[model samples]
Target: MRYIAIDVGSTFLKAGQLDVQNLAITHMESIRMPEPLPNENPLRKEWNAIQLLELMKGLIDRQLASCPGCKGIWITTQMHGFIITDEYGVADTPYISWQDERGLEYADKLGTSYFSALMDRVGEKAWRRTGLWEKPGVAAVGLFHMLQQADLGLEIKRERQGKACAASMNDIQTLDSKRLCTLGGYLIQSLTGSHVCHITNAAPTGLVDVRAGKWDKDIVSAVGCQALQFPRIVVGIDSVGHYHSRWGGVPVYPDIGDHQASVLGSLADAKNEAIVNMGTAGWISRVSDAYRIGEWELRPYFEGRYLPTITKLPGGRNMAVLVRFIADVGQSIYGITLTEDTLWERLLAEADSFSQKFLAGERQAGKGQLHVHVGFYGGQTGTDSGAIDCINGDNLQVGGLFAAAMEEIAAIYERNLYVLATAGEAIRRITFSGGVMMKNAFLRDAIAKAVGIEAVMAPERDEVFLGLLRLALVSEGLYASVEETREVLLQKLHANNKGA
Candidate 1:
């Protein structure tokens, strides 16, 4: 059997054909995500909902054309953003992305930010129920911002007028509805004609009672969003409906969160292993058999499992900051333009050389090294500032800078492991995935050495799609359980390697 796996990622929209019998991806394709729409408030990151839907459909059509015998479609997407839609799933507003920070803006006479006001009204219990950390970009925060604008009545009018003016030039819609869902849910509704989302995606919205496996009525009432329509929650294996395309009607599963999907795809042993994924952002997650709350964000995992995760750690995006800085200096001072790829090549080489020297006792740790904190973006503790300290004559260069940054990133992971430990998670090994870990061997080594554990790379390159494929298998009844499926697939992989 075959299934089509789609990942509506922040950076790219990816699709692949999963050959279930062989346990391998036969074909794959991707395109860059649509650029964010221009807004008067630069902090507001929005996308053309209809445009994104059309682009995703086009990508699926291309995939279906390549694999005509595909049995079903499974999707996973970037978490924590949403679009308002009507009963029929037609978008009423632009897609508010996770990068949107409108909630940070002051909202009232008391000068309380929208996020603060929402959290204040809802109280701390909402966070415990949702198993999510309070963030400005969460769907609840965005919805509260919209509700406040509508209640105040002036900003919504201005926004409506602006959208009306732009509607003639572009096909954008104005904000006019109360129903909201993630981009993945919107796609599933458009495809299968069902309005639903998986718990993995809904839990991040700060409205779901993750422990109860349903929407929290108290949170909905407290947020003053009782009029809003929320998607019905489903499990990973639940089929929403069928998508009737020209090729054929295929079973469409409910959309899941990309973070959960990537962890699932990592194929790490959930009992004693943890996963460290670094993409645009970074997170370290470990599976728990029961619901447990701690300093970390807890998310619903497949098979009634819960993942205690430390999210929003600096990763590839943070490294990009340093790369851009070096490139900017090169262009401005040396009158030469340097590409990011060239800069990364040089940086990785230098970092590797430094690691070799340190291991050989030629270079001493902390003697002349820079103390770099790569938290260019704020972390979970609300620490928005990052610093580089102990800078002296010996480590001010680009190579040493990147090396120090890598060390700091690794150290952050090491420090945060204690949070999981406090929550009673005993991690014996770490499975690493994401572009940063895949490309930078020195970073991987640094993290392994720091964590004092055996480290292994994720078996597959496209962990999101691989995860979706696993879900598809279970959903189709090919396997009795996720654990059984993993064991069988691992056995197949082992046998393939032995035969080779």
Candidate 2:
């Protein structure tokens, strides 16, 4: 029999059909991200729910038709977003991108508690927390929605351009919630017709009390949003019930965070291991049975909580973030309009050019001064006041393929591994995936060499989809536990002889 796994990612949603008994993938495909429509608002139009959901329905129908007798549908999506629905089923918001920076100015408004400490506690490197309100770009709306209206009410706020800060009047480049749509709640809604969120997204809300695994009233109040609009909370895999009671009673299973799903596919070991998934961005992560109330040492470094939970970044987010800026500059210079146009081509060309140039540079490769400290995230904390520390990224370049770029990615990975090794409990084997691993052979080789361990790469691993599939396993009664699934998966895969 076949099972369906849907990976809900930022750029596109991907799906794959897996043979349940054999754990083999039959077919997989990802659709293009549709452009936004002329809607009530430009941002709202970008997430055009009606258009996007229709696309999802069409894809879902086609995939299921191909995989006759498919057991269930499991989905994984970006965390920290939720849709406000009335008692009936309806969408109140679109997908809220964690990359949205609406929450950045929040820390600035908190007055005297010294948001720095709390900011540190929130784990800045998480990527979700890297925006103006001190929250990541993707989750700004959710924070505003979930926070008490009385706290961030219109009367008490300040505005820059047209938008206002959550607390008091202030000026900052905040992300509009409408621009970034919803996340977990909608994914669940689309599947089982239930409006619930998984632990992963809830943990990042700045609303959900991570320790209790429930929404905290104080946090809710502090956010200046509402609690009533949110959905019910559910653990990973507990069957979202039968899918809509339509199409012969197929079941719907939902998993946790986007990275968590990939973690499942990487080795199925739900234990301790730092997952370094280098896609549009690069990240490292490890799971703990119990969530620490607050762990600053654990933050990724650069962009705040803007990254996946598995991400580790002592090098910070600035370095990686800049890669894109550099890419933009290069593309402009090359007259290439589309920056994210191609995967392998862009990566190979840039890295190769940079390597050639750096090897041939004449910037006086002498001593102390020659030692380069590439800061995309943490280093940005001081270097230029505004920088990202994590260096391994797809986009960057103040301009051109500065030969230091390759070393930038490598150096970033090396530093983050140090933090990853220290933050969580005992370390298990490291599993790598994402766009970065899929494209960059040099980065992979350097990673294996730097990590100094037996590293495995699945030339066929579509982690985004596989991660979602693993969640379906939990949601469906087909498996007893994720741990069991992990054991089976790890045993089956032929580990590569180090990095290929």
Candidate 3:
């Protein structure tokens, strides 16, 4: 079977068609976001779904024109999602950006503290033993909620067994009237008629119960979204649903977090491999079959819109801005613009030389001698347009390349790494993708050296789109399981790269 995958992102929507028989993407397309208002304030409504869908539809339609035989689809989006819907399944709101911390202010209203405390008791590791839910992010949110609710219900239920057990995690149900799913689920249902989700995307929202594979008790109480509203839960490899409507009802599967998708698409292999993808933002992730988490990870572990995980840290995109401050050392001398490909080639050459000197143990290390921003992203300036709003990635362009500001960014990135290593120690290897890395090969090499690991490039150019396409194909059940699919993929990639 052939499949079409739709990846609804913050500023863009991507779709790709894959030939399941060969397991390769045949066509790819993207739609850029419409510009925001003049005042930069969001309009009465951030976006209309119909318009967004039409945008998506147009992209998919164009691809379908080439691959008429496609029969399955997989859709995935940013981790925490929301879209308003009408009686006819039309959405009122476009899916919000996974990067949108607009919900950050609602943290208190959502009872985030309770979950924060709960992590202290439980953990962020994936206990993937059968019958025990072990998803990491948003999926953990829902599962944890179910366990909490079950505990609460068990407390409320006066059964002898229940009384003997003291409310534990095992007595949860999927029948909750007030189950809530991220806005993405609603969008999936509207498009395909199946309310389904996957572990990766679901885990990021603090919504899934990692151990129980259900909603966290506190989440439903706080978010008040009905479980019935949830799309059916499917393994990342299961058939999501048929595309059905205009694009043809191809079966669809959901993907996990966008970063997770990027991780998988990067071809990051087991326990030690990881990567730092610098694009609109940067993310460093390593893969593990078993989850590693601790009290330290627990305390600072943020209960994001999804389930709790240990590797949680400050922002990434903001960190890139910090690099830019110091980047001008070579860039300015060469008259290179951040976005210019040719300019970057020259800048990278100089950065490589500068980085080598620093790496060769020639630079003195005194806290006061040189300082940069790595732990948090602010007081920095970079060329990225959204860098400022995302304080974690924003910078003020304090000094030219090699300037104090630039030094600060390197310092900050290093500091951030220390903090992350302290929490997500399980990351084994680092991989990288995205335009930023492409622009600054020196930075990529520098980051790899800092982590003491080799950074693997993504198999294809856009891991984001590949992940979505992978999800679409997986959800279609074109293959029996993700593991199997992965095996096939590995074989094919090996065959192709044999000479390399």
Residue 374 of model 2, lDDT score:
46
Alpha carbon lDDT at 468, candidate 3 = 54
lDDT per prediction? 0.80, 0.51, 0.48
For candidate 2, lDDT tens digit of each residue in 1-500?
A: 67777666766777778676766776787887665333443232225444556666666777887877778876667655544433444443343455443333343355523233344434544323321224343343434522423344332332222232344212111222211124645655766666676665665555555444566565444444432555566654556666653456777764456765666566624455666776645566665454332333122111112222523232323334445665676678885554443533565566566555544353355212122344444212212234233343432443233324445556667666666565556555666777657656666666676667656675355865554544455545676665666655555554432433
TM-score of each: 0.93, 0.70, 0.65
Candidate 1 deviant stretches above 4 angstroms: 156-178, 358-368, 379-384, 495-500
TM-score: model 1 vs. ground truth: 0.93
**Residue-by-residue lDDT tens digits, candidate 3, 416-459:** 55544544345556666766666555565556665665566667
Deviation from native of the Cα of residue 244 in model 1, angstroms: 1.3
Provide the lDDT at 118 for model 1.
83
Model 2: per-residue Cα lDDT at residue 412? 60
For candidate 3, give the lDDT of residue 497. 86
Candidate 1: the clashing residue pairs are none
| Residue 363 in model 1: lDDT | 42
At residue 20, candidate 3 shows an lDDT of 64
Stretches of candidate 3 exceeding 4 Å from the true structure: 36-47, 92-94, 102-183, 224-230, 246-248, 295-316, 319-343, 356-370, 374-428, 465-480, 497-500
